[model samples]
Target: MEGHPPGLETVTLPPYSPELQPVERAWNLTDEPLANRCFESLAEL
Candidate 1:
């Protein structure tokens, strides 16, 4: 079940697995820089 052209690769995920989703990991990291910081307004944020 593993075949792809040269260096190309494929990924598969099962249904309803938020913990395994890559987007969740990205969101977790995105919050880091804004964690302890305060914003002047919504526009500043």
Candidate 2:
């Protein structure tokens, strides 16, 4: 197998960094629809 060398990398972030994550924003936006609504089937959800 041939591939580029691998090494550990360090990631840094500031406190309260979830605001920068898109998935977090999406989850927050979907909270109301997911909570107050009921789905009859998996497809409906």
Candidate 3:
């Protein structure tokens, strides 16, 4: 809460709890290319 205004509380989730994080669900789409193949260069990528 360093950047947030006072009185705003933060809750910490246990490690490895992917179900609690929505972004975890989208990782498959972003990771698919990196997992299936390798790119030789930035242009080819």
Candidate 4:
């Protein structure tokens, strides 16, 4: 509730909500720089 620590907010989400996950939101940002780019191997990447 409103009594939570200062500047902190609590959120609750349904179990199946993929859009709310951090990684789900980060994919586009991470993918944009790598689009059409290639590395010789996994280690290079």
Clash counts for all predictions: 0, 0, 0, 0
Go through the candidates in order and give each one's C-alpha lDDT: 0.82, 0.75, 0.90, 0.87
* Model 1 per-residue lDDT at 26: 89
Query: Which pairs of residues have clashing backbones in candidate 3?
Result: none
Residue pairs of candidate 4 with colliding backbone atoms: none
- Candidate 3: worst 10 consecutive residues by lDDT? 1-10
Query: Cα RMSD to native, each candidate?
Result: 6.3, 5.4, 2.8, 5.9
Whole-structure CA lDDT of model 2: 0.75
Tell me the lDDT of model 1 at 22: 67
Q: How accurate locally is residue 45 in candidate 4, as Cα lDDT from 0 to 100?
A: 77
Error of 4 at 31 (Å): 0.4
Per-residue lDDT over 1-45 for candidate 4, one digit per residue giving the tens place of the 0 to 100 score? 888889898889998888778788888899998899888999887
Sum up the clashes in candidate 4. 0
Relative to the unseen true structure, what is the C-alpha lDDT of residue 7 in candidate 3, on a scale of 0 to 100?
Answer: 88
TM-score preference between candidates 1 and 3, better one: 3
| Model 4 deviation from native, Cα RMSD in Å | 5.9
RMSD of 1: 6.3
Q: What is the lDDT of residue 2 in candidate 2?
A: 36
Lowest lDDT 10-residue stretch of candidate 1: 1-10
How well does candidate 1 match the true structure in TM-score terms? Answer: 0.41
